[model samples]
Structures are given as structure tokens and as C-alpha cells.
Target: MGVEERRQQLIGVALELFSARSPDEVSIDEIAAAAGISRPLVYHYFPGKQSLYEAALRRAAEELATRFVEPREGPLGARLLRVMKRFFDFVDEHGPGFSALMRGGPAVGSTTTNAMIDDVRQAAYEQIMSHLDIAEPPVRLTLVVRSWVSLAEATALLWLDGREIPRAELELQLVHDFAALCAVSAAYDDGMAAVVVRILEQEPLEGPFGELVGRLMAIAPTVMEQVVADDRTA
Candidate 1:
């Protein structure tokens, strides 16, 4: 293979190894052996194990960021649900690697590694903002989107530990969580309210957001009755 091709092949090999186990556990010798090359040849392509690990991480980060890209032709809730599905798909496939990267296992505190993770988050933020189609989003709106992104990351990390909750259910709940965040924000901010209005205008009753509304509506009377009873007791 040519230089670039060899580098890419090594990266691919490293990523596969990294995905299966922590980068810290995988050594240069293993990478070289996996690539069917000598350790010196591996060094010729990269400076050290750290550089190779970063290259593999960069590749992983790029792929993770792309998972958030969805075509803008569906209801906002559906689009987000699809995005969540893809995000979890990556997590499912790269369980150990995702855990290590997010939890700061290998190359922890490394500026480049942190920046690549931030780049992925920023990419997700931009994708969400584009989906929201907000030219100048209010602070609350931006907060909601960024917080949801973080929440998704945290959720994935927790889910990886035991995976007790069903992945499909978690994916759906994340979509509902986004809607809930927006609704709560809308209650306090007029700008968010308007955004929510615009979003609901495009959502169908069968969509995720609408289903959330329906579920809340279904229990509203009971909740109100309990409130009334508590008020009377008071």
C-alpha cells in the first residue's frame, strides 16, 4: 500500500482494536501485528502509540458526528428520533470505545482528544440548530439544544454500563425528553414559546411530540383531581 493507504490501514486496524478494547490496553506491537507489519514500520507512519490512537479517535469522532446528520424533510420530533436512533447505533457498535472516549480513558486530558470530542458535540449542536431552523436562537433555545445533547451523551454512557433499559425505549424517551425540555423552556420564554409553536405546527398527532402531549393529556384529569383533593385537605 501507498503511504496514505498504509496510514489509513493502520488507523483502521487501530480503530478496530480500540473499539474492542481500551486504547490504553492496546499497544503499538498489537497494532503492528494486527497490520501484519513490524513495529518500526508502524513508527514510520506515526510518531508513537498516542498519535495512532488519536488518529483512530479522530476517525471515530468524525463518524459519530455524521450520525447526527438527518435529512430535513420530516416532522421535528421524527427527525430527532431518527437522529437518536443513529446516535445509539454508534454507541451500540462501539461500546467500549465510546465509553473510553467519553469517560476519558485513553489520552485523557489531551487537548487534541478533548477538542475532537467537542467538535462532535458542536457538530451535533449545529445539526440540531439547523433542524430547528432558527436563524438567531434565544438563549433558552440554545440551552435546551445543548443540554439535550449532553443529556444524550450522559444517557448513552449510563446505558453502556448495564443496558438494562431497552435501547429502542431509551431512544424514544430521548425524543420525548427533548420535547419536554422545549415545552418547559417555552413556559418561561416567549422566544422558546414561539419556537415551540412553530415546531408543533409541523408535528402530527401521531408524532413523538404529539404522543407526549397525548400521554400527558391522558393523565391530566387524574393529576388535577389529586391537586384538588390536596387543596381541599389543606
Candidate 2:
């Protein structure tokens, strides 16, 4: 096999083993034995078990990211539903692979994998914000995007660990939960807008509160519109 092909073969073997057991539970020797190769050959491909686990995780994340990337110009709600369906479908088909990727432990032990997880989180955030019609400066918007992504990822991890629900059922629950959050954010934005309007009318300028309120005010209408749209479609 070519270099890339050989590398992929090793990754495949490692992932299969990882799905059945924790990353640390499967030793390099065990992988070599499963692949019918000597332990030294395994070492040549992956310096250690950690390297192998990292590669397996990268492989899974890349596969998932590819599955979700789609045309971005359509209505935000439609795009989100499409992406969510694709995502949950993947979870159904590749549950073990994904579970292994996320369940792999502390970031401190493997900075590379930690960064990889962060990348996955960021990508999901972008996907969601894209679907939310968020069109603010990237730096300013990161906080909102990051907060929503945390909620989604945490919910997904919990579902992954505990439930074996069918894809359709889980998708319904996700859409319902997200729709509620969208409504709450929309109402908060509207209230902020009223505060900003009060400040702009030169009635009172409450320093940081005024500035913060103004920012939320600017996005309030757009957020409400997006929430209405998502509720209808989702």
C-alpha cells in the first residue's frame, strides 16, 4: 500500500478496537495483533497509543464535518434542519465511532486532541450561527456563538452517553429544545432593544449597561425574525 493508504489502514484498525473498548484499554501490542502486524510496525506508524488514539479521533471528526457541510445560501431554518438531520443520522450510523471520539478523556493529557475537540466545537458553532442569520463582526459574535455551541455540545454528549433513541425521535427532541432557546433569546433581545431605545432617546446613559444594551438592541429584531423562522421550519 501507498503511504497514505497504510496510514488509513492503521487508523481503521485502531478505531475498530477503540469502539469496543476505551482508548487506553487497547494496548499497542493488541492493535498489532489485530492487524496481523508486529508491534514494531505499529510503533512505526504511531509513536504510541496516544498518537493512535488522536489519529482515530481526527479521522472521526473529519468524517463528521464532511457530512454536515452544505450550501449556506438557503433559508437559515431549512439549512439547520438539513444539517441537524445529517448530524443525527451520522450519530445513528456511527454512534460507536463518535462516542469513542468524545469520550476520550482529559485535554491536559493530549493537547493535540484537545485542540481537535475545540475545532469540532468551533465548526459546529459556525454551522449553527450560519443558520441563525447572525451577521455581526466575527470577534463580537464569538461569545454568543460559543455559548450556544456549548449548550448544543453538552446536550449531544449527554444524549450520546445515555440514550439509544432512534434518530427521528432524537431529532424531534433537539428541534423542540432549540426552538425554545431561540424564543428565549429573541425575547431577551427585544427587551434589550427597548433599553437601548430609552438610552438613545437621551433619557439616561448607564455606562456599560447602555453600551451592552445598545448591542443587544441592534440584533434584537433580526434575532426575533430568525426565531420565528426556525420555529416554523424546525
Candidate 3:
């Protein structure tokens, strides 16, 4: 293989090892041995185990972000549904790498790695909240957006853990769950205008005041139903 190709091969091998075991658990020597190269050759590409681990994670995150975040122009709900499915599909194919990212099981420093995860999270949150029709510059709206993003992250991690779930079924469940959250968020937005007017004497709420609060409140019941339904199925 060429230099770049060999480097990627090393990365691919390193990811398998990293996913199968902890970062500290596997040594550079082991990776070199598995890649059928001298330890010095491995060093040529990655300085150490930590470097390889981070490289693998970056590759995985970039692939996932590209698949999930690119190609817009659809309804927000449709886009999210597609993204969610793509996420699960990626995890299904790269279970160990997905596990490391989703669970944070690897020992890689957050400085380099967490940034990518955070970027994707923020992008997803922005896309989701943008779809809502809410009064801008409102407190309730901000809260709703925060709450929905938090809920999506938590639930998605849970889905990652339940690797036994059939891909089709998992996607279906996510769609239903996300739809319910959006509905509740919308309901909350509808009621929030009145709620805000009622509490007008209080501090001013800002940014999609109605829709934000709606999305946030909507996440709670959806969470409850998810737990209950999951329990029943379990």
C-alpha cells in the first residue's frame, strides 16, 4: 500500500483494537504486530497509541457528520429522521468505533475528540430548532431548544447501547419518538404564548420564546413514554 493507504490501514487496525479493548489496554507494539509492520513504521504515521486512537475517532466522527449533516433542503423532521437512521446505520457497521464515541470509553483527551462530537450536537440542535415556528427572542423558546437537544443526545446514546435492536425497528422507534417530541414541543409553543403573557410581569424570555418552551416541555413526556414502552418491550 502507498504511504497514505498504509497509514489508513494502520488507523483501521488501530480502531478495531481500540474498539475491542480500551486505549490503555492495547499497546502500540500490539498494533504494529497486527498491522504486520515494524513498530518504527507505525511510529512514522502515529507517534503513539493516543495519536492513533484520536485519529481513528476523528475519522469516524467526520464520516458520521458528513452523512448526517450534509445535504439539506428537506423538512426538518424529514432531515432529522434521515440523520438518525444514518447514525444507527453507521454504528451498526462500525460497532466498536461507534461504541467508543457514543460511550466515551476510550482514553483519548476531550480537547481534540469531544470538539467533533460537540460540533455535531450543536449542528443537530440548530437544525432541529430552526424548523419550529416560534416567536423569536423568547425565554420559553430557548429552554425548549435546549431540552430537545439534550433529549435527542440522551436517547441516541441509549439506542447505541442497545445494539441488539434491529436497524429498521430502531429507526422506526426513533421516528415515532422524535415525532412525539416535536408534537409536544409544538403544543408547548402554542400554550407558551399565553403562558408568557400570563407571566409577563416576570423576567423577559428571549429567542423563539414560544417554540423553545414548547420543544423543551415536549421532551419530558416523550422521555417518559420511551422508558415505559422500552420497559414493556424489554
All candidates' TM-scores?
A: 0.96, 0.68, 0.64
lDDT of 3 by residue, 27-144 (tens): 8889899999999999898877677778888887777667656355534444555777786767666665665665675466467777877876666656555544344545655665
Off by more than 4 A, model 1: none
Q: Candidate 1, which ten residues in sequence have the lowest lDDT sum?
A: 102-111
lDDT tens digits by residue: candidate 2, 122-213? 78876666554434523424554576556655556667776766656555455444444444444567643443243234422342233434
Best by TM-score: 1
Give Cα distance to truth, residue 2, candidate 2, Å. Answer: 2.9
What count of clashes does model 3 give?
15
> Cα-based RMSD of the predictions, in order?
1.3, 11.7, 9.8
Best by lDDT: 1
Q: Which prediction has more favorable lDDT, 2 or 3?
A: 3
Ranking by TM-score: 1, 2, 3
TM-score of 1: 0.96
Q: Give Cα distance to truth, residue 127, candidate 1, Å.
A: 0.5
Local accuracy of candidate 1 as per-residue lDDT tens digits, 1-234: 999999999999988887778787888999999999999999999998778888888999999998999999979999999999999999988888888888896454488899998999999999999988988899999899999999999999999999999999999999999989999999988999999999999999999999999999999999999999999999
